[model samples]
Target: MPRSPWWGRKVARLPERGTLIVSTDLQGNYEDYYALKQIYADEEERGNEPVLLLCGDLVHGPGEYFADPARWPDYLGTFYRDRSVDLVLDYAEWIDHAKTVALLGNHEHAHIGGPIVSKFHGDEAAVLDIRLGDDAPRVHDLFRSFPLIAVAPCGAVFTHGAPRATEPDLASFERIRYDGYARTAINDMYEEGTLGALLWARYAEPEHAQALLEAVHEGEGRHAFVAFGHDVVRSGYEKIGKEQICVSTSFGCEDRNKTYLRLDLGARYTSVDDLREGEEIRKLYPKA
Candidate 1:
């Protein structure tokens, strides 16, 4: 039986209209996760078509917990609870809905057959696997089903990390393969191949990102810009070079600096310049 294209496919092409909301590494902040969800739900209620994209890494929160949530000694003093387990459940549920799509982050890849990730626990994947228990396989399946990249008609390329790739073209990404994993798993995520660049590279040069976006939109012969999350951006969102934007929604930054991206998909954008903080690049918790 052929695998469903919507599940575990290397790339996803989004529609030309509606609203697209993008979130970066959730790494365990359940509060921020729901905050973003509210925005999505509100958009739908307001009669706007909404599309939600989760850019992976919704794992590895604080290892030790104190009675007080904010007492975890976090920067900017946040109530950082690792409700990753709960978020994982919600994440899968959202993807089950036709309007949501998830892109695999390096942390997610760690569990099934990608590089091992460690933030709080020594081996986050191993520890998380134990925590997941019988549900681990199901959770892994959810991760495996995530697309590596999502392209929208508005010329935005949404991915987990930097756009640099060892491969010459996007087709190489589709050719990635894995052995002894879910038939639904996206291929070669564990290797230092194209998938590695997409899942792990930070501080990637602007030209590098632009080139990859070009290839991504090459079929449509459209100019494209890159929007991704992997590294922390203190200001919540960063305009990288002329063609890329980086957002930090739920991890690696102060509570106020955490951010997401929201845009009218019907409008076409040519560069990161078109996005403004508090507008397209939104703060999950705004500072009053």
Candidate 2:
């Protein structure tokens, strides 16, 4: 098995590899949450292993709250908060699972992926302190703490939304600041008073993805595979050339009755879909 290319240093000891259960867009979908728990429990009973990775919108939906951060909690309400915390905490508690990582989606930004202003009712800092607390791998600080989770050796980049491809890989994956093309999106869509707020809106149209892939391939070194959620991809995965791959598992539970990607580190070095379709994981979550 190859090590994560993003690390590029000494290969960390690979654990006894197992099946990974990738999911996202619950957005307070408690039933789906419980179903996943049941699935994981069954996997454990059968002695099969499972891990989880989330793309975004884990808590509130896009329309659940206003863009203003100050009114975040008022919009989130107590019910939403409890559900979000519960689902996240459940994954952390899963002992037999390999590991878990989730990215902050556009819905998380109270201001809807705008500039880093004091938008949320408790502010980003206060929310992190209060909501996350002792969990070193917390969910609130998606960009700052766990921006990009790399699992496959072919340099897969796991992010919440479609990153501006032209941005430097290290910079895009390493910091809280939304610079480069994403920044341009913020400026053109919001700061300059553009008609449409592009950042707030998820990337649905294919032209934007084309632009993103062009930007991504511009970088040097081994290209990083980008996996994200937001756009509703019924099939759960999309490929740009042989390098960039995007997955949308949210459709399954809500409308399409599907789940997210399950990657196998021991698989061939290619797109995220390839990893998910690897013999180990597919045997369980077969795509019909």
Which candidate tops lDDT?
1
lDDT of each residue in 72-191, candidate 2, tens digit only = 443232122224456555544542243445545554543233333242342443453355567524444333332333333433445455543333333342433433322334435433
Relative to the true structure, candidate 1 reaches a TM of 0.88
Candidate 2 backbone collisions, by pair = 69-119, 69-120, 70-119, 165-215, 165-216, 166-215, 252-257, 252-258
Q: Which ten residues in a row have the lowest lDDT in candidate 2?
A: 2-11
Global lDDT of each candidate: 0.75, 0.43
List TM-scores for all candidates, in order: 0.88, 0.54
All-Cα superposition RMSD per candidate: 4.2, 8.7
The local lDDT score (0 to 100) that residue 275 gets in candidate 1 is 87
Cα lDDT tens digits for candidate 1, 1-288:
112244667787788889999999888778888887888899989988888888878887777744366566655235576887888977766655548878888888777677556667767889888888898998988887778888887979888987775345567667765323323233344246667778878767766776677677775423568888888877777787777788888776787677888988999888888887768878787762
TM-score, cand. 2: 0.54
